[model samples]
Target chain A: AVAMPAIAQSMPEVKWRMTSSFPKSLDTIFGAAEVFAKAVSEATDGKFQIQVFAAGELVPGLQALDAVQNGTVEMCHSASYYYVGKDPTYALGTAVPFGLNARMINAWFYHGGGLEVLNEFYKKSGIYMLPGGNTGTQMGGWFRKEIKTVDDIKGLKMRIAGIAGQVLAKLGAVPQQIAGGDIYPALEKGTIDAAEWVGPYDDEKLGFQKVARYYYYPGFWEGCAALNFFFNDAKWNELPPIYRSVLTSAAARANVDMQASYDAKNPGAVKRLVASGAQLRPFPQEVMEACYKAANEIYEEISATNADFKKIYDHMRAFRNDEYLWFQVAEYTYDNFMIRARARG
Target chain B: AVAMPAIAQSMPEVKWRMTSSFPKSLDTIFGAAEVFAKAVSEATDGKFQIQVFAAGELVPGLQALDAVQNGTVEMCHSASYYYVGKDPTYALGTAVPFGLNARMINAWFYHGGGLEVLNEFYKKSGIYMLPGGNTGTQMGGWFRKEIKTVDDIKGLKMRIAGIAGQVLAKLGAVPQQIAGGDIYPALEKGTIDAAEWVGPYDDEKLGFQKVARYYYYPGFWEGCAALNFFFNDAKWNELPPIYRSVLTSAAARANVDMQASYDAKNPGAVKRLVASGAQLRPFPQEVMEACYKAANEIYEEISATNADFKKIYDHMRAFRNDEYLWFQVAEYTYDNFMIRARARG
Candidate 1:
């Protein structure tokens, strides 16, 4: 039988309010939500229009989870770890210290049964989550002084977050949680000695290089931070199947897009930072070793206390072990050789 | 103004035939096309149903492109590199020796102007292309004997593809382009000494480890192989805006899904292969160095002769260089340290 031709059909104009944890100025982070909304609107032929609000416009940044759960808004775009105060399992939805990297997370979420576990965890909260955005791997942080040993972190006042901050506290450093906007002034005024944002693209925008000279490598705390799109369960179930597929597809695209934006933009930003006299340095092995040890202790402590944390953490750890072995053989070997070879030329 | 509610509306029923280059037995590769079709159908509320035909069911696998271009079918899912015989530029649409990895390709395609260049390249053929799927990094190949030095490659009859085969030939090996199904028999009978398909998931299905004990890793030629969804230009232009958006979103999801499937499945497959007495190994540095040199020379020769190849090659190389540098700092540093630390524990 011949197929019928597609004809113009007026779609129902559904508008949604989406609260983002980020202010609009950080385009790559906040811009992902806008990209997703645009794609959804265009895909549904204006049937689905989501109005995005910067952090404080609808509710406080960290309170987006509350907004989503209470049905204050139909949806929200925020880092899942921001709601770890409610349940530590929420941190796994985003990232945790020494957890999966971007590729591994993608594998776990889409293929290795991560999304199922996470959605199950979210069932108690009356929300459904989708992978929204990723910032590949973040920089360790911007530091005013080089961190050489475990002792160097002692008594150090730094702006960090979540489990990483807790691990840092174990190392005798003072972990202060500060707002994004406030981090720079604190660093500049010596109220804080170090701070980490995302990577070069977003970091350069925050002008972290202006106050910090020693730029550290690899944010082990957040290997790859994922942002999630939270939908009210009732609102989500009420949507037509087509809209649901579009939501998954659009968010998937946004996830790749945000990280790509960071990857493409960061090179130029890093070069500029270096030209402006910022010194790039790998965190000393001693510091990394110390952090790793502290991170394990914190994980053990949390697992011993929190059933939810233990359940998800155990699954994540197992998957990570397999992922690393495979990657070490296929990915790392290729990348290490290629990078060095490319450098030699 | 408050938004109107979505009501069930009668929709257009469009059916198209999609030819895939891969056989259905290799589910991850061929399964991607089915996945895309299913997503498209469900997203359009059963209005858009695509009938997927495996390789040789309708037309030959490699000729899927011709079927799409000639309008014998409205769409076809195949790797663009399969058309390297038509134009070497086609390799850029898929992969090249040491080209962009899965994440880098996603970054380049979605964010770094790869899709623009590729689609512009495809315009001459009256087809539009979308990123369909990827096989993360591939295993180098399976060999009957261990290859420890550059000289070990000489006089070896191996099945490889694209520029990689050409590079292998330069190293004094006879590069045979054997079909996937024929590789096992050829290897079993010793007509071919070695072959490379994809990674462990697909490789296990092909049962290569039974004949070839040494399974080498990090396929240099295809660091990541991408598959594309080709649409007849006229047919693509005929798609409604919403349908077009759905197509983009669906394809993007498929891209992420395929790689994730490979990453998630390969580890277990590799473990099984090892248990079955297959030895896992990396290609030696001497051999890698030789292949890199030969690959560069071939690229130079191609650029000197083919303008299209040169144009995309130059653009891709520039983008790849920047991508590697950024990835080196953020991605590599993080993964390397984590893998080592995780291993120690």
Candidate 2:
């Protein structure tokens, strides 16, 4: 027999506020938090409601981590890399250059001991993290010129971030970390030669096509960028078991929904971009190869000095190696043939 | 401000029973149902409990859909394709030959209108469906001898089920659908020339490797097989909104956890299978090409007579086409490079 809700009963209604690292205009990203909140509210019979505050509504986007840590906000939907200044390990929780893609990251976190390892790191920060959403593999960036070879990037000035920016700097590119809103103008005024934003869906909204005609893909730096719903430790522990379950499931649903929205919407965006005369390009083999070399070097150097970084990095690398092998044999082979076959038909 | 849960209160208690199409021995498949039940109970603070019954304990495995539909059981966890006898449209809820893989399937269902379309179809059967789990990509199967060309499949006997079996029949192979436990013995006794179960993890447990030396990959027929959780319409609607939300999130979590478990476990299973003298091989390109051709033809023939099948198939086909194109430029390219690089290292 199923449990029926007791009617005419009184229970305390709970409400909370969440600060998002993204503005409402980027619905796909910010919308995941909204989706989580609404589902949680509905699941709790309207007893649990979380009001979402856009970036700068309550605190600047980058400071979301601080807000949650100090209890300025109970929770946040934000990217992990925004707090890399605290520890380089923060970047691994999100995405790293040449790292796992969206599916692989999910596999790692949920199955390959990644969640436990990362949570141990988060425990020190006085918060708990749950996967909020993911943007599937991102595009390389919009460029004003085609990069024909490795040399093309040597003197290039580009806006990139986190470990990726560090990797590019080693390859002789001057990496500028600019705020998202300022990227288009930087590329337009020749202040920067290129700027990497998210993939087609988000990049199109930023008007990158208007300034940069060449669009390179497989942003090796961000194969997949994962966003998290973070809860303060004491507040999280105080919640009833049922509400905790709601939060867990709601966040997981949001995780799947966000990526699906991106995947569904991105194809149309790419089509529109091409129609607008945007050229799609793959980063030249020479450049990809050089970046690959630099990324590994950077990993090796960081692993030498940071114990926590080394610990998680080593585990992730091994897990990633195994994932790549398995996917190549099954997923890759099937996809490669089918894409070509469908095109032929 | 964050609201805390009020203590010293009583809530109603509920219990449920889940009928599963899989036996207890197959933990990964049957275990997902257990996982969902346990999560629900815990989330409800013991106010809800779901006792699980293995196939045949209550009803035969294939009868799971009937049990749920009739309210003989409140819910059931099984593959949608198992009930294809009820309607060919049912197969679309699981997998079809050369169809979307695991990640793409998630995208289609959650965001590409697959869920809405399929749920409408399910409403006729008196149940609501939620994605329960996925076996990422299954292996082609175990072969007693090497298959070098399409011709080798002409007279072979294989134990493969669903639409894939029909496609194999078109290619001149004799198809047999046997219970999982019986396949290994049949393959060993020369009753069947080949047998396809799941991937390495489950296949190894069944000792398929000991009897068959050639293990082929990219089960083109089942690029990914999705299992589903079905709740009886009457019983489902009677639950409180909070309970419904619990089920939604719980099922979603199970959906993700199942795939993660397989992905995490399969690599080790693969290595062990090779150690046991199982020769790993990809199905010859010629065989794959022939199967692909047959699959498309079968879809066309079925679409002509089955309106429900045609409607969903067309949406899925268009969605699959777009997904393949987007994945090619980014996911595929990056994977193609990284896999080779990792192997080389």
Candidate 3:
């Protein structure tokens, strides 16, 4: 009887295209798309194949969301914050300055009703989304000179992205939106005084350590950058239930794997970067306080004008507060002890 | 041609029995097995079905690994530390005293060669393992009295599991092994001085707060407990590539989701536990340091005798050290700031 039902529910072959907002050379992020595609194919016995395209093969990197929305490609893997110009709500889908970290966000999305809240907003844009990857906590960026105070940020031309750039703007810095490929040249030519990309592995690949000697910790802007897979609403609905289930599982696999890859690789990369003369520095407490204040101000301003942004922001902040409370009790204490023990050894 | 290949690769009708070393009431842990089963069934179009059995249904919870090894069950969901009596090396597969945290362990398992190393040792027992779930950093336990110093631990009868019990033994505490269902009664009847179960979510369900009023935090012995899916090696090899891929992806989904569920649920449960008269306390630094020292002594003694234990311990400790170097720089600083801000609010 089980065999008969399985035969009746025979799978149909389906092929789709996935465009990523990252170049293939940055395998940790770009490779997530490949990982997703491979899992889908394997699980479906090659019946469901998704061809992955690095940024620019189908369209420019920034235009990936547009491509998925307009049906040029059935889906895309990109950072949700890249589309913040459309609405600040988009930033919540990825990361915002002083927001939830990697673990907190995953918990919120998978168990705390985050996906439902986000999908409800995405519906109007003709897209459906699933978390695809995370970079963990990213480096603040590479800087040519040390910043000792908030005053140092004044008039500084920095290549940053999303609402973080807006937060920095409130503190008198000039934020430039430069593509990843161009950040190196911009920093080298003095076109930008500083640039923030990912952590050590990807940053070292781009050779930011050569031009900028001062490397900062904890990119306050992007605490943990969550990459998402956006699918055309109609196309997503058209899939058989089994195919959808497979894709969801595959995306989850990519989501967890990306962070694991980063965590595994960044340790070696950080050591290499430091050995190559990149000075590791923490942002001054005064500067961090100022940025925290500015970030909150920006959130208040956005909340005053956008209901969608306000709803998600309130929900996430509540969840975040509770998360930190629990973390402080066990996770933080255990980690602090271990870190100290490791340092002593 | 693609359709022809897909049709030819029709999935086989297979049924499996999965025994979990968790009770049905503890949904977060037991629920992971259900999550894995659902994914397998959905991906296989109902052709592949896995029937899940809670602890004591088919065999005792502690015997889950033996069931898989002897082919009494195709697989089992359990913690490797339960089998530490067989080999101290088994503790490394789950969590040992002062082991890696949730994110760190996941990173190590998936990317930092943890699975390869673990499977190598597991092979001798005719078992193959995949990370099934993690509970994040757990609460210390419910204590009938406060533990203010190393002196307080002397002659204390505590119910703890695995290597932690041995570590406590070095500190003059008498450790008792009790099943999940028996811990509450032991604590209530004054048969045990203290009992460490899971975090607030599961502990509350077991009503430990009613018997033990002093709730201590930061389960140092298990920074994170990683549950595992132990499959019979021969049966695992016999599966088609498609089935294997599906199972791998499904297990990953469960692995990520379990922590998410716990993270989302624990915060609320903790508040309720405290509200209901559980006085939360942190283990004093003096006691922590003593336990830490004792744990290392045990490690040294075991490492000298067990080659497998030494090899994995050295590798994991090296990885753990490097991970903390990175985490302290960014992750810790950022979280410390946020926690302070939340407190201020």
Candidate 4:
């Protein structure tokens, strides 16, 4: 009903496809892609629309990055670590064993020059990335039997992802890479001894509790698993500046909403899980220490050969140290007090 | 370069003014308003422009809500707690004594029905609100002297905000509400014995370190102070749907970026402050416990009379309890381990 501004009158109508690395059932993760798309559409008044396809619709989840890189898709939502086979450096883009947590990663990416460093590496592959989602500290995978010591890992076969699998292999465990849909059957049929998908919410969705009795805590490999939206560099550069800003803002909203969804949903899921006869356990200190040591050994070994990996790894580690120093003093202290008070009640 | 879509061709150009309750010098908090405005302009191709004014440009900081409500400005950026004088229910929109931290509040607002509940109350005052910024767990304050027990608080005059002041008054401490710029002089001239601001980064700017040698931490009263963008309900309803979505996305970006900026900057600021001879101290357990007790007593009294306050307060407490239970398991243990390892190194 109002007259149009000159700039708005010249805007272009655009449409694109987005493939997700998650299933539609795990709404928290997959839903983030939808959130991004919806925001873009709403902000542009449907002038720009993105169609979202769940994993396997266009390609397998693990192949999401390849699809974008090869021009099979213009953009896709997936974890950077899923492409570690192409470059170990990819793990740093998502997370690494004993890497920064959700808050720390966000701080590093947004203000600590992490995005610049990461984009420099990603440019080599013709991909542009934006943080799309995050699952706060995930639970340790579901295990058929308890893990109390490093020796327990010596003969275990576990389904894991990315660099974490390599870290486990160093400790004598046989690591298996399985798709999300296949993890349950693999564990049920004795193909795998343990498997981890995500935290209580997603883990509950996969029915892992029915098959595995011992559900563990502190997914060490993924202190926080951040997902990304990968845009084909050529396609990204072709967009009008206004659309680019809209996309960036949309991705940022999805990033915060995903974590908030997980934090709010996980509490109730954990309660339901425990009531379903799932035995909750924390990794023994001995196992955690050994894994921590082993993880560092692998990082140093990789850093010696790969310049990109070494550069990002060193930067992230430095940032992580400072974040911990500050967190211990105030954030941690306050949370610790609240936790104790809740327990007392 | 490209032809405009039909919807874009009819879009209207709109300009509005925004007043902020913070000065320009406190960039992390005040700058969030700038960030939101910039994003909106960029996304709309300058068709929708918002000009942001710092406190006192349009109205004094404390009058931000009044300016928006009475149509002096279309919108204003402020903390909901700043208007507790209008109604105690205002405190729940930002935070309350010993309430949820930054992450928890985001989770509660976005997913646990917090935004809906708070907006129901906000609508009564002709305002529409969206979370715009957050300061992660803040420092307690700058104190002229160490407080060892409840006795030390008996005659102390502290500059505090909102409901925290009432909680402290119950403990025999005198509470003073002073504007941000005046705090340094108040502490220096013995007008107030202590003052609490956001955190290390903001506190360092206020030169509180020069006035008070003792810097205490874990500001229990304001665990995480969230800021909001308040729009005049009539103006909000008149916006094009596209403009509303663009504004919402922009505010969300500002919300996350502010916290990220704080987390990234505070560590360096803390190091600098300590190097300059600021003594870091934690509140004694006895005093913390006394404050905690007093805070709950005050909440109970408020809930007994205010139906809106009781409804939201009870919901937040229940959510807070569940959140702590989950946090202690994975988030806390992971952070605690990382903190100790950092210490050992």
lDDT by residue (B38-156, candidate 4, tens digit) is 99999988888999999999899899999999999999999999999988999998989889988899999999999999999999999999999899888899999988888998878
Candidate 1 lDDT over B1-345, as tens digits, reads 733323223234678999998899989988888878888887776778899999999999999999999999999999999998998889999999989888888888888888998899999999999999899888898999999999999999999877788999999999999999899999999999999998888889888989998999889888889999999999989877777888888888788888888888988988898999889899999899999999889999999999888988989889888888888987899999988987897
lDDT of 4 by residue, A252-305 (tens): 999999999999999999999999988999999888888888899999999999
Per-residue accuracy of model 1 over A111-161 as CA lDDT, tens digit each: 999999899889888999999989988998899999988899999998988
Cα RMSD to the true fold for all candidates: 3.4, 3.6, 2.3, 2.5
Model 2 per-residue lDDT tens digits across residues A70-186: 999999999998888889999988999999988888888888999889999999999899988899788999899999988888888999988999998988899998989999889
Candidate 2 CAPRI classification by DockQ: medium
Candidate 2 ranges with C-alpha deviation above 4 Å: A1-12, B1-12
The global Cα lDDT (0 to 1) of model 4 is: 0.90
In model 1, the runs with Cα more than 4 Å from the true position are: A1-11, B1-11
Q: Scoring each candidate complex against the real one, what DockQ results?
A: 0.56, 0.51, 0.74, 0.75
Interface RMSD of each: 2.7, 3.0, 1.3, 1.1
Better of 1 and 4 by lDDT: 4
Q: Which residue pairs collide in model 2, if any?
A: none
lDDT of each: 0.88, 0.88, 0.91, 0.90
Off by over 4 Å in 4: A1-10, B1-10
lDDT (tens digit, per residue) of candidate 3 on B1-345: 224334445578899999998889989999999999999999888878999999999998899999999999999999999999999999999999898999899899999999999999999999999999999999899999999889899999999978899989999999998888899999999999999999999999888888989999899998999999999999999988989999999999999999999999999999999899989999898888889999999999999999999999988988888899888877888888888888988
Candidate 1 chain A minimal-lDDT segment of 10 residues? A2-11
Clash number by candidate, in order: 0, 0, 0, 0
